[model samples]
Target: MYSSHIKSVLEEKMWLFQLKYFPFYAEWMLMVLPFIWLITLPYWLPKFIVYLLEGKHLVIKMLILMTISLLTIFLIYMYVILGKPNQEKWKNVIFDQHIKRIAIKIYDATDNMIGGLVNRDVEVNRGIFYVERVPPLYWDVLKFREDKYLEFTNGSTGLVGLLSSPRAFNGIDVIGIPSAILHRRGGGSSLSQQLVKNFYGQDYFRNQTSLNKLNTLLRKYKELDEAKTFYHNLRENDGEEFKRWVAMYSPSLVSAGSVYGIESVAAMVFGKKPKDLSEFEQILLTNMYKYTHYFNGKAHENKCQKIKNGSKIDIKTYFAENPTKVEALIQDIDNWDCTDKPRVPLAFYKSMLAEDTKGQLLIGNPNSRIWDWAGTSMSILRHETEKYKIVYPNHLITEVKITIDTPKNISFKDSVNKAFQNVETKLASRLHVNLDDDAKSEKKQANIWISVVDEKGAIKYIYKRGNTHDKRRIGSISKIFEAIALGNRGDKYDYFYCNEAFQNLHNADGSMGGECQDNSQNNIYSARKVFGASKNLPMMSAFDKYVVKDNKGIHLIKNKIDDEKLQEIYESFNLSRDNNVTLKYELSFGLTNSTPYGLQKSVHKLTHLLYEKQLNYHEAHIMESLKYKIVKESKLINGGEKNSLFLKEIDSKTRKMFDKNTKIYMQTVLKSALDSKFNGTLKGFKSIDGYEPLFMKSGTTDKVVNEKKLTQSKWVAGAIKVKGKRYSLVIMVHSENGIGKKIGHHEIMKPIFKEIVEALNR
Candidate 1:
């Protein structure tokens, strides 16, 4: 019965272990099995029995049980402390209360500082709960006033308010002082020491004995003799100390402004004194203003002079001589009256002197010219005469000649008519106005005359006109002729010719006779020699050799002639004792062939050659390569229709490859060409012949035709067209000089070429 009861009790204890720790034992069987075995011997014996045991087996069992029990206790304690086993309910209650308190404080502070209501306020009597609400006020309002601060408060669980208040008490007021001062003061120094350091240096109060002596001397004599003596001694004893004293006591001697405690010294140095308090303030203020304004104005004047002179004048000497000019000019500009009839007043003139003369004095009329009103036209003229001495001196009044005299008690209509008449006959040409024929009749009827000369004996170029149709036509025709004369003419052709011709037509002596002829040569000679050599032969070829080659291509290479040799040939040609017959022949054939038109045509050909090369190269690389035999057979069979048909087929196939490759290459080539030739070095060459060389490389590509598609598209169509058609070629030119207008030659010739090409293809 006793054994049975003991077995029953062991069974009940085993069942209790299995129920309480069975899952953990199963999961950590390897970890728990040894510990269970270690404690099993003690578990079988009573605690008192185990303690009484003294044999080796009993002692070992007791030791093992103690080790296992201690280990188990340690693990359980760790689980309780670190893992918070069985503590979630209590922890949640405590943490919720803490969070609620913090949230309430934050909300209250935000409402107190910022004038706004918070959203989703929580009532936190015991614990915390999450609630969604609007965001806090934005920070941008800080820009309005720095002193403002926002406070937030939670009145209940779902409500909040933001109030504005001073930032000082809420803990952010000490941020107004400059960062430099704050940083130095934060380094643990007394306020008095900081003040001294700001006015003087760190060593000013370091010596107590010296400071005491200075204090006693200042008290007795109202002057710090000890301090003065110390500084004097430092001047003799230490070179660096002497420099510091000089810098502090006499800054104006070595620099330009007063140093700390040096205002009296500065006055003494300048040998000036104030009679009264106001006088003292005024003198100091005036001196300060003068130094700042004078030096800065002088610098600005030097800069302006440098810009005006560009690479010609030295700025340092220029400013030294005329420091006050820039300030005067700026003052004048600021005071200018833009509301006057001409929108220019006395101040405008003063500013104009600086701008126009660039500091130089004006002795004659500066405002009379077109440049005073138009900057672009002025720039154009300036560029043209950059090497010449053209001067606009000062403003001058002039009397102009009119076509009709002023009538007595003139009616408005009559006055208008008289003005229009003057414009048509005299003023219109100069002013660039156009009048109709009916306006001329009004001029004759009104008896109006406009003076073309000014009070200063200067000539006026512009005129007013009457309502007569003829007078109106005179102005209109003048503008039309001006436009036509300026179009597409070569640079070598003299503008003086057109100007001279216009003057002569008006029965006036030509203004260009001697000055224009100084640079001019016989048109025929220039055309035959210069144009022929530059375009027909190699650019480096001699005139004589090129002339010889003109009759035939053989003489050019045989002569081995160049530019140096060309000069000699030209001199020889000049010395030739040619009769009238020979002269006529040279003039007609040689000179005329080298005319501007001929040069222009030659340049056009060169452009065509370049285009051909580019197109061929692009087509060859970018097009689908067809077998030569196929193209050849197609061409042979299609004989009469070969060129057009072959080009069309090749173009279609090439267009596909254009997408895969040529699109990018074409863009690159176009941009390079535009940069290199159109917008860069070639920009100034507006004349057709001058632009010819840029396209020369393109012509060379025609000689080496390799791809069937290129041959078909470029050669077949181009060759056929060249043989049978006289296609009109168009050219475009751009210029910076503004000597002439832009020309779009292609726009004019497109229709002509279209008709010719269409007829030939049909």
Candidate 2:
């Protein structure tokens, strides 16, 4: 009895193994069968020729002639098929030798995009998912649901009714094969053929005319030939481990609207990675092979209905608490068999489809650094490709990996967030504005931007709750540049003739306005006092008298010493790449427009120069050596090629813009702007840790509203150094009402700076 049982078990195991490798055996059969039949031709040819010459055994002669003709044609067809090579070269274009996608990846210092180095506010518009190998459940469900004869068939056209219509001998189904041949059409395609069509065929085989049908069959023959090569290649490369990846490349060609590929579909529908898909989800995706964009959920609605509401929970909370319970719940909902016909409500499917169509079905946050880096990397790709004239379909470039050279420390991000929340809460109460209410009117709302960068111009932190890119009348921040321009021209002191109409220049009553309260008497003030106090009229007079050249006694500021020097300064700092810089004599009192990014970059450039001035050759060489050591050790530990640790340095021309003496003098003048008696913008700011202030400046610009002059822009910019590190900071605020209204310095900037100081000190 034991022997008999073992015999049955062995037989069953052998049968299963053959069934699993049926495609391989079938392809070999097609390849080798012609040679086996060739032997019979030699034996039968002589008899057929004699009978035909005698004209006696007509019946026998006809049968032999037909047999010889069929075998000869079959041999010729097999020879032609074997001669063709693989045309599926698109993979080589998209992926490198390691099979990793050939696209630029942005990483933070830690080489991770979604790590805790930044805020978790990323929102991806249409995300893509990538997997090393597809799950077994996916293949099982796909084969059983898509084409039951998938194992036995090569990816070629059906052989039935060959006399009525042309076809390839590909499908090897016991039942469907005869039916397809009798009907003079193909029954279905194997997964390999589906992949071929998805990647290369559909563009040429869309129409179904007779000519198109013949071409399609020819194409199918090539697909079968390529499938044979692919199977061999996959086995030679990695054995059967990556067999499931065969279908991973089959994108939805005709059905899915904008989405393509299994990875993208999985991300779009379930917001899950390919490996994370439940069995039922795999089945549903298998059904999408045919219905794609038009796939209604009615077929599997009943099985998935149990977890419809559960899926709607906030994703953050879903993964945070009782993860085991969530997994069990998902498993229970996915427990249904793929063969069971669903008969449930269609609402769940409809809701998901609605979300997808509206572009609201997201896998990651749009406000994240991931998306920011993605946008930048994509632009880089476009620029590089266009410059070199290398063009390919954009869809082929789907996968990416991001690596940031200097990712922010996670602790730093947490500190920034904590400070930001405190500031928001304080401002909400002080302004009496429901900042959380989406329906609030625009006039009642206020916006703020805080940007920070390292001395090398790499952004370390940014909090943008406003239109930071919108051009704002920069007011007094331009004074920093004016100071540098004057210092460059060797102007030490000498200014007078303060304008009496400085402050109320925009008043609707048409009376000449005033800029500085101290300039009421048109008094002559020293240049140091005028700049330190931000006395608009005296600064204007200094520019007019010493900087501007008299042309026909008009003394135009344009094309003069001040204009040329300021333009040169802007270029050195990369402030205006397009030459949109417009400088006015009233620049110190707000006459030019600049974005937050532009302002931050200018400060960043200055910080670089100041930092470099402190570094001796020995210290600089030691720092470079330390950086190299860190990078090498990281690669040795992490086990892959890492991003280079080289930071871009200031060019020679930019460094030459300010001599050592002039830079030192500029810093001295800027420090006085923060003193209490003059332009005390930093008076409200508190010191943090060992970070000492290097320089500071503030500006306010006015706008006419309801026939009254109102503050439109309030900005403060500065730099600080601590522990051998330098950082540039810019804070900009905008309001429809003046800053003195519901929100003021006490309620907003002061408390915010205080909180930031406390956070950083920790």
Candidate 3:
């Protein structure tokens, strides 16, 4: 029993081994079957010997038979898989390789064509080009030969690139073997519908529709000339239409070349092809060239017409007529003087002086300076004196009385009260104040005073007591009158008082005289202050500080001026100076005003002397004499035959006057001994070298009037016509206003003396 059990266990182990290793051995043999069959003639072995051998050892024979059967089956499989009895394999291979080669060629050609279109050159790389029937299909990367088609199947469906020789199968014409076998063999889709959509169109396969539409249009047009003309007009009138035309025509031409190649292949097969290029092909080629030429010619013509027509209209005339339009159009052109002057708003003026007393009165000063209000009050007084002289004539005054009080008192009984009464009852009636009688009556009670003076230096009337009230009313009324006067004078004051202030300041003794009052301290402070303060400061810093500081002060004062005459002069020269020039002078003046007020006051007194002389001098006589001297000098310089002799003569006379004026001025200052030396000689002298002038006990008192004649001197003069017409009146101011240690007293007076000479000559 033990022996039987052991034998049974061995048998079970043998069966397990057989089950585990048999299949592996069979598979190994199957793998080598093709090589074995190729090398051995197993099919030719004797069948009788094989049967006899099988009967003698059935189990062994069965195993041998099974191996032989497996080998045979594998051999058959090799023949089915690797062998090519039909030309199908050759045809497929050739077609695939052909498609690959053609695709590469097409890619090279298209790349070159595109490069040419955009003016570029690029090299091509190897790849297959294919069209997919479905969207998102991808092409496979494989080694392609000359006669094989790339085939793929998705599920049960098959696809092939190109076609092999046609063959009949089951009554259906199968152009090539179904791709299912290749697909099952692991081939993949290589091209997708997306590529076609991008390169071609979504309906590219729906052939003849676009072509037919284009052809129909061409047929209806008939003549190429008419078609060209219509296309040209379409391009000119409608860009979308032109784009559509180009799209339709361009593709048709490209496809025509492809169709021609197809036709050539068809002809070789069918044997009845046309001998020459087809009419359609000819039309395609001709239209391609014709359309291109037409497009270029039309573009050239349009450009030419644009230039020619543009030239025909006189730009100068157009500008003259439609200045605003031209300005708007050429707004970006650099350095364009859009108008004769800039149109600044009253608000801008207000903003510029907003920090000063002037701005406060015009718009209300948010940051008021003490000097700003004082200077503005003074300026308004001067302006009012001049204005009343002109308008009231007999009522012109040199002195005014004003009273100041608290706001409550101002609202009650003050100079403002009397002034308001006068304004409402008399001036308001004449000036046309836009206020109701009740409002005027209410305003008349305001706590301010009014005063009047005559041109003879006599106080005509006094309605106020305090200087504070006088200054407040003067500042306020001055500002209001200035606005009214400026408005009546048109935009001239707008430019002069506001815009030209900085520029004028610059031209006036290296100060930006005419810039906006808020641009420099010179505008705010007296000229003496600007010079005094700026003496110690660097040129650049002086200018910058003055512009930032003094400008507000000047603006304050300027806003209070009511003299139309002053505004006229200011506008003519102030707003026209260069920005850089103005900035420099503004800075200089700012520095000058940074010093003590005593120094500033002293300088102003000197300036007052100069100004008084200017105003009192016999201008007509001086101008006439100057004109004569100028003429004489021109003849001496340019000869008697000169056409514009007056110009040179004027220049000569001007120079002489400047030189003489300096000499006279210096002598007067030295002789007066206003310097610290000879203390009693000029009793009121503030200093020996830099002294303030003495004042008489009374305003009308005249200290002395000593006049002296200086020696005559030759001068060079020149003039030029301004704007083809107007004459510019030029005069030089000679004083210690120039560089270096102050010039000799005689030299300082030269220019003034020269002016007197010129006036006498004229």
Candidate 4:
């Protein structure tokens, strides 16, 4: 009875294991059965021919049945592998269109972001792998090092070998896969298979917990199909296609704590371009293919063990006996340098591989040479996709090219950095505190945020000193949206009296006021002036008259402003995850909570719309031109097919934010706000030296306690044209401790504007 019970328990455990891994076992079984038949094919061929000559009807029937069975199994396998993975369930034909909006926004915001893989100059600038430039020895060594059993020209996955040999889906050596799985042995893969895995990500095949054997098999099959298709289509032309393949699929190397292209890796390791690398350096890089992370100048314990044990075996003998030690041996060397540098080729071919006792090697790991220069633009892309609940594949070959207008000697980063430094210096001077003094209370310190966008909708510069995404009271910048909405309602030029009765509560000192106020009391202002001058009383009167509609006698001011109009604008700008519905707005101006980024986008859109109207151009024309160029270029990259993977489709029906005539009118009104003759608040800031034709508006928010007002927020938001290009610059300064000391926008922020213009001119 005891023996029976023990037997039953063991049987149950085995059954559970089988049940859990059924798909895994079934996949392997299917492969192994074919492998057996493949091995016996030569023997069966002679007999099969004899049967055909003898006209054996039973043999023909058996062959038909076998073909039918195989076809059914193939169909089932295709269905399982080709079906969309659960991770990408959110993406479909409809939701894919929204991806275009995100892509365009990112393209605009990252217009000046430095470096990327998709640049045309990558081959010359970054030294990414090019067919002509790469040393032939690199390929010879790669063949010997990674996959020695077959010729590499059979395409990425070695599809020919896969069909001919008894190997796995990726053409892994029959003996290798079983050893690798059972004993944790490492194995080689075809180049196409490796590239496919790289497309999935670094850990897609490397991490077992994240992907089980069943999923790996499925993924491997899919990779085979993709690689075969891409290779056949692109290589048909027979010129630079291989280079393009490498450019697209190679994984990035880690350098300076970030993943970068081949040039960065080369700089980190040898301080040289790939073409300039010595033979020893080439060998070292080839060796790094096995273990990328192990090459970061860290001592590998396992590799070092063999060195410590003083093994004197030659390279061929050692490689043959201990294949696993190949990577360990290479990594444990002095700084990854070859000790026998002068005789590198001779030693590599003839003698034993050795390590250095005195460590001072410059050798580091080399990853597959793929460029990743998108920089901050990638963050915007991520935010938008996440907001829309879409899982965009990371490996899509998205391109972003910017036509920088700055001087060649001065990079975008350097110019933007200098501009911000000058602004920080100005802010420090005003606060009378050291800019580096972190101990100062946050409330007492002034925070300035600047965002610049060009007429092409590209965000050329953004202040990186503070969190631009932190939602705060946007103050009168909200009036841009209000003005556009009211313009749509044909009330843009409607005049309203700046009533003192509707003003904000004044401070005892009579310096500033809170919430709602129009200092120009009793003056009549149009909606254009209300926006350009940022007159709160006139804006409120216009908002109450034009926007706040009476329905069922229930107050709908909050819903109309916050829920309907503001939400639409926010969504149009694609402000990631901004909850406009919950925000409470008592009047038209100064209380709309928004990020500096969002405010900048709103101002940029308004100014660009005005500029386009003034130039007699339409936004739809620009969108269509951009869309056509992108789609055409994308199709070229993907071998003359509109790759479904690319987010190239954009909505053609673009709604004009404001009427063309209204925009033209607003442009003049905005310019008037910067004119001294109009008694504009920012008239003093009009003379920006070389960058003239300045149009601006100023906004201020104050808090009153015990009838004492404290200035909390101040803004100077507008556009300036330089060299026939419109650039909208939005500057916001906030203080936690009330800045009761009065300082006009002209006096406080004009210097920053001048510095920015100087940087641009430089």
Q: Which candidate gets the maximum lDDT versus the true structure? A: 2
Best of the candidates, TM-score: 2
- Tens-place lDDT per residue, model 1, 79-163, is 2111111224223542232222211111011111000111123221111111111111111111112123212221111001111
lDDT of each model, Cα atoms only?
Answer: 0.23, 0.47, 0.25, 0.45
Cα TM-score per model: 0.14, 0.52, 0.14, 0.51
- As a whole number from 0 to 100, the lDDT of residue 267 in candidate 4 is 41
87-203 per-residue lDDT for model 3 (tens digits): 343245422232222121100111110000000121111111111111110000010111123122111111111122122111111222234334573212111111112123323
Candidate 1 TM-score versus the reference = 0.14
In angstroms, how far off is 704's CA in candidate 1? 22
The digit string of per-residue lDDT tens for model 4 on 1-762 reads: 999999999999999998888755665555565557657868985686566547558877678657756665554433322211232322432123212322221122223322233222222222222212444444445545454553324332322334554333233344444455567755345554564565455454556445587667766665544544333333434324433343333433433222323333444445565678764455555444433422333434443333323222223333566666654554444344422221111212222123342211211221111112223233443343343224423223233333223223124434544554554555554442212224454533456566566665555554433334577776665565555555554443433334233435422223232222332332444444455554565555454443221233212122133346545655665433324433224235466666666667666655655655443221211111111112231223331112112222223222455566556546555665676655566776666677766457667776664576566667777888777677877777676554444555665567666756765565
What lDDT is reached at residue 530 by model 3? Answer: 20
- Tell me the tens digit of each residue's lDDT in model 2 across 172-250: 2224433655788664554545555554435446564458778777676655555434433333333342244444444
At residue 17, candidate 4 shows an lDDT of 94
Q: Which ranges in model 4 have alpha carbons more than 4 Å from their true place? A: 1-137, 151-254, 257-378, 384-395, 402-448, 481-500, 503-535, 542-588, 613-665, 677-679, 704-708, 735-743
| Order of models, best lDDT first | 2, 4, 3, 1
**Steric overlap count per candidate:** 87, 26, 108, 5
